[model samples]
Target: MTNKPAQATLLPDNIAALTAYSSAKSEKISGNTWLNANESPYTKEACIEIRALNRYPDPQPQVVIDAYSTYASVDSDQVIMTRGADEGIELLVRTYCEPAKDRISLFLPTYGMYKVTADTHNVQINSLSQDLLLNGEVKDIINAVSGSKLVFICNPNNPTGAVTSVEKIAELTKSLANKAIVVVDEAYIEFSESYSCALLIKDFDNLVVLRTLSKAFALAGLRTGFMLGAKNTLAPVRKVIAPYPVSTVVAQIAANALCSDAITQMRRQVVILNKAKATLIDWLEQSPAVSKILSGEGNFVTLQLKDKALLTLATNTGLIMRPFKLYNQDNWLRISIGNEQELKSVKDWLNAISAQV
Candidate 1:
């Protein structure tokens, strides 16, 4: 008896075509220079004192929930903690979208997780070009999202760093009332001046906001993130979440980070990153090697390069940056805002390369 082929017999077709998310650390390059991921170069001492690691942590850690709620200016009941903003994206698909039935709509050149998670659950994806979203046209967005059950908008959008104004988002959500659930991902909002749509949840019951401590709060290793919505809007997600969503150690650290002093420190760091981002943008704008620099409000900047040779030069110099081949935006690269020294080194390396040519 011949055995069936594993790919043909076991794996689902949707997953078979799926390309896994390649995180910056996935490169496995060991080096003194690290800037591929948009993580804080600074880290604080954990000083974690958890009562128990052997036993299971709280199914819903009150302190962690309370900390994030206060930080996001939402009530605890409006918050649900997940492994990271990534998991929150998954939970939204699992809880609301029916496999092979409900569809999710989002713009291109945005975060990869929104599409990846939606694809994993076998949900149909209606991808809209960024032209409409970037222009902030509500009617175009409404037309684009006509049949989608879940609409995902990444504010201070990734890769492009383009931000949709809070007022524009409010208008979109208002128009889509009862038509679809509006999810605003604010993963990079801390670096932007735009207000969070979490403030609009009260007005729009269907509005859901996703946030992560990974970026501005500098808690990437902890894998902490949040989902904010009205109680009824989040009810389904709460029902399907992991028994103990967050570890005790993580909860302790997250709570500490939420304290007033730490928050102030986080803000100060954001100011520094914004400065670095602006400097880098200014330098890139002047460089003859750059074709165009995309507008964004995140700690990173994306630029269309004249060629891939610059990427090779950066890599050869032990500098790591993200290339957008997977996003189908070839020849485009995202450079995360690192410490002052790191930014200077990268700028010097670019200048040296330009001088060689």
Candidate 2:
């Protein structure tokens, strides 16, 4: 390797933000049933034949759409299948958000990738202040980020796992009409009180609801996600996407996963996950060290602990929980709602820590 230093002027001005995204790390600790990334441990319905692999998959998988149509009850034309909702997020930015001419707005300590994607194109970002979540800073976001071309909301938001009302969303959509494209990310809505915002696509052309098979349907490994919007919103996205956006294998398995029986299975499992989540929430609430538990409607729960050092205690015990750094809430940690055993381990860790004090 050459030791010569590169010229300073050659360094791109915005490249630092472009390079900040880091992939979540994984550890293969034995008997450590994984739940760090909000993935279900069960297998999805599958019958993707190898023969189908000979042909390129549909750019927007019809089978996936039909399945999603029946599952989500939106028209097939309104859906655009993706690699995961993450891709849907990227597609929206590439389609509508021009680097210098446009801007993107987001409320945070939510999903990081939304900001990351915008930063990739040198898009201007309008982020909420630290107290934005508690206060009605959503009102401020709309007023302050005037002329923002795109707005993103992660319902039952990531990390916090709190939800905003559909009525409130509808009001925001109506206000931002033609002014901004509002994206409602429902990746975790399967476990929420709110239904998928896909239904709003019929009423508002400005709305784009991002959903994923990864969280609720246990299809994260398949890398399949979808976007629901009027055809107009997707037209520009189509222009920028690859011809074979989804693989044949993904389409077939996704189709199989969408069958009636599979839908029933997911609904049944939702009941199970809800119970597990409640159990963990009650256990967490009993601890004085745990001061706050955000209304955990998603497949995860975030807690605010008295001792910031307990974050290390949870991790060193072979649990890979995500400690939030976005807002510098050093005392907070997020734990995915795992199956019976996994939740028990979290409870046990908390119990041990409480005893030490």
Candidate 3:
């Protein structure tokens, strides 16, 4: 008889209790329209020249660093590129939190990765209500997250598109100085540039802003992002990051995406998507199926449905949208702004549903 392999060991309690991040389905499921993941509706192609396949890429590609630094209005040393902002989150957690000892904090109805990464590192998570950050005073916010090592604030917050004032964020950083690192995840900032907390990095040593090319730059496939802060804040993270986090092709494409011309195109696309989102909001406002329009500031619109069954109807029509059960309600749905045709399909589906009611 053939010898059998030994049984696999059970996962640690921290990991055993966790669920994997539920990313939007990547496979084509008889639908050509995909607007679930907050990805840019437009695609800007880059003229890539592949060279040096045999050589390893720079851990932090200088070309990408220089271009992003100029674009973000930060010094070259202030930026450190990662596989994506997701990796940046992981790196920050790994570098700061001590397993089973230190904890990280975040306001809920925000990005899920903050808690997920902290959990993966075997670190405790302190989840405060979004109201604490949105409505609480700086001291109150500080008191709430007193023992945490890193605090993640997702401005133009995911799923909700609610933006916290830069002044409020700056105040929180100042109050929490030396107590914890305030990480502002600006994955959707390109859609709402004026509210960004990136400029506050120079003044606050404890503040770090996370950004990604995945959304606005329309380079999701490249998986490029940056962590911007004072060099000291990033030094520890650098020690823990992979030696070559960015692949050669990713660096070339991301560098191209950050070029002056590409940035202009991205701005133009943002304008277009903003208009599309406005139209979608208008439609949602008139729909009987939509109970409330929660937010539409970012690249997506979130609303509470009059009936949760509407989500099933949408999916049945080959329309995919992100579903949420936020603040004890299970009727919320987030629809990404897609191309004109895709938006039209959504509108038509909503109209048909409205007529039935």
Candidate 4:
């Protein structure tokens, strides 16, 4: 019997180099004031009264599917519920792109999951060159379509908050027919003025829209999201998904939240956050510490701060916000639109810190 040297060769080269998603919370930093993750500050009371804990959950829960379908104004066949929108990204890559053969394209400075998911599957990732604020141009996406099997577009894009018009998204899909599947992630659509591209599922087969209860619905803790596309288009994705992707309790709670009264409450909360978003933008615009602010339609605002020390000061004073070194923007900070009390605390801290400096 002989023991061989243990080297990194045991793991695939790509897997060895992967840096998984990490957030402040993941780092065990629990702050009294949290404005990261773009989550709704309001917490929904769960209605988890499932009697069958011993039984497996449904692969596709009709109650949740129907509820989300009605909310998105689409048919149940077009909806495929997953653990979260993150899972949908993985499912798409697994279903469509062949490992080490097919490739996917994602715009820079957008959501990180699309690249992460594609990388996990050993699929090649093509970076489509486009400006963070002025990159919604269809021609740029169309030109990048060559040699790509999937294309991911995050609307009211995460981190930067830039949005692409529905017309442009539809046009991009039509232009790239059979070239790639254009996935429009609309997780923050509830907070945007643009209509969901789910309505265009019937018009174009290449378009897929991702929605989540984590944002405006205030159910981030529940971990529920959906992918809206033609049933035939998602059939392969459904096969790749777990047999029981959603828990019974999660389904029940999501169903309850989609009720008429709950939806009205969600809309009212969105209205409040929209106001907070505007206020935050206006305040940031006037702040001496802010060098530039890339305002978008998302619930959060991205700002390029004049001083990086402000981020450290905020964290030291029990305030937590997302800082990005992504896309070569090192001094950028992302602050989620929190409830009035939370945002007020941020405002107070900025004033105190600014006055001292």
Candidate 5:
């Protein structure tokens, strides 16, 4: 009898090497203040009527498609709802990129999901600095990502809150037309509405804009997101997507949230959060503990701490915030905009630390 090979050896090399995406703590932890995930502290009550628990939902629910398209000002055909923007990223990669052959491009220090998804599919990544796009070096960016299958741009960039101009994105899409699918992730667009690249989808067949209800709509639990582009651009993605991407209950709740009244309420909440973000910035600015305020947009504030010990201090005090290392800078920290009481707690902690100094 031939000797049996180890079970682990059956796993693909790429799968063996891949590191899973690190998500924020979902279970209850030993922290009173949770401000790590960049989630809205405000929760909107969703009234979902129970129905159709047995049958599978539509692959692309028309209600969600219509609602999101109407809100995004795109035709219904241009949208495909996914589990979240995360799934949209996966679908785009699976649809466009051939494992170990076709590659995707990403501007670093943006969303982690883009890289994670690319890696999971055994797709090669052409990593470029965020500065190339931020500085409007469109020609260089185009040249660097030449022949890539997809290029992802995260606007009002996560963890940094850096906003890339619409003009730069338009220039990129036009320059790389037919060469690569240019994906603009507007996950935080509602916080910086003027900088969205969604409108340019009509102009560029290669451009795909990703929008999520998790940030502004306060529906992270719903796991709903949309991809906006020319209908043809999204056609291939639909073929790769799961049979039933959105569940019946999630569809109803997301549809209701996309309504005009809910949108208005969402906008009002955004205004309030922006104001709270401003307050947090003011506090951070005054705190001697903060070395520099890196960014203040998209419902979170990122900063460089004067002392890295402050992170440990916050953790010991039951204050949980996100720690980041951008371009080898290890002192970076991100704080999500929580409610008034949460903000006050953060402020007090900063004050205490500053007083020690």
Candidate 6:
């Protein structure tokens, strides 16, 4: 209340560096299979009730919470729903990260939103520079958060798509206690051969792991995402959250999917996509334009090029994939595993380009 200037918003001015997230609206993507978002190509097969959309979705839908909690094997009190996993990240930042004061950090080349959300809250992000596995960066992470409070790890991380081996993640969680909040984003754990950090939430109150239906449920338009954390950890975080973060249609469809025959169908699709991913890696490895493929435990794969110039050359044709320049991964491009036909489209186009090169 002294003589300080009036603040413009709750966030810091450096928050301006964060850009609005734009999904691909290009024509090339529409014509091909849609796989870039890690979404289930399958739509909600549930018979939509006309009344479902007419009424307001449960503000805290008990059924949806219970289902997600049970599916994740966590307590109902430990779950919180949001518009999407994207929204869940935002909620966590808003509730905990103090812009210009407290900071949030993550592994370089992991999820972009952790940094973006922190920036919006004016929370600085310190990232440790490490290659594929996060083995050597323990010291880097410790240094980044000299005065920070949160550290986020995108398991089966996006862009790079590698799951930090559980041994490494657990070590980081134990070591970071009292120093920072450890957020393990298991958005792609379904595709992994490993168990989810969800089962471990009770043991570490400092851990907050994220999961989404947008990928496996094939419900992108429905926009549903959730976070798992200890009840004590969520209490202060809950105070700053919105009242109606999730919609009715999303809850109904997602809840229905939890118990539906969707799991079996989903697993079948995974088997197909994993095979395609391996095929693409093999093909890309043979191409001179591609340098190497990064390991991801998620549904997608990221190919690192000798130079980003090759990626730029590919995108000008309207073939959209994620870019990693901001993360110092200028030579990397992330591609989601779509259906067989879509895979053919991407492969054929790249092969054609290979012939010309």
Per-residue C-alpha lDDT of model 6 across residues 237-343, encoded as one tens digit per residue? 67776777667766777778787466677777777777878887787888777767775577787777666666544555545566556445576677887777677
lDDT sort, best first:
3, 5, 1, 4, 2, 6
Question: TM-score of model 3 relative to the true fold?
Answer: 0.96
TM-score of every model versus the real structure: 0.95, 0.91, 0.96, 0.95, 0.96, 0.86
For each candidate, how many residue pairs have backbone atoms clashing (under 3 Å)?
Answer: 1, 2, 0, 0, 0, 3
Determine which window of 10 residues in candidate 4 has minimal summed lDDT: 128-137
Q: State the lDDT of candidate 1 residue by residue for 25-120, as single tens digits.
A: 877775567777998887888898855888998877898888888888889999998898999999999998999899999888788888889889
Model 2 poorest ten-residue lDDT run: 22-31
Model 2 misplaced stretches (Cα beyond 4 Å): 1-11, 26-31, 129-141, 193-195
Cα error, residue 59 of model 2, in Å, equals 1.5
Q: Which stretches of candidate 5 lie over 4 Å from their true place?
A: 1-5, 26-28
Per-residue lDDT over 125-209 for candidate 5, one digit per residue giving the tens place of the 0 to 100 score: 8888888878846788888999798999998888789888899889989998878889999999999899988889889999999
Tell me the lDDT of model 2 at 349.
84
Deviation of model 2 at 346, angstroms: 1.0
What are the per-model C-alpha RMSD values against the true structure? Answer: 1.7, 2.8, 2.4, 2.0, 1.9, 4.2
Q: Candidate 4 local accuracy as lDDT?
A: 0.85
- Overall local distance difference test of candidate 5: 0.87
Q: Which of the predicted structures, 5 or 6, would earn the higher lDDT when compared with the native? A: 5
On a 0 to 100 scale, what is the lDDT of residue 115 in model 1? 85
lDDT of each: 0.86, 0.78, 0.87, 0.85, 0.87, 0.72
TM-score for candidate 5, residues paired by index: 0.96
lDDT of 6: 0.72
lDDT of each residue in 1-357, candidate 2, tens digit only: 755457545665676437565544443443354557787856754654787667776787776788897777688888888888988989899889887778988877778888888887778888864245335655765696578888888887887776777876777788888899989999998887355676778899999999998888888888888888888887788888878888888888888878898878988888898888888888988876787888557888888888878766666767677666635667777778787877777887888888765
| Poorest 10 consecutive residues by lDDT, candidate 1 | 321-330
Better model by TM-score: candidate 4 vs candidate 5:
5
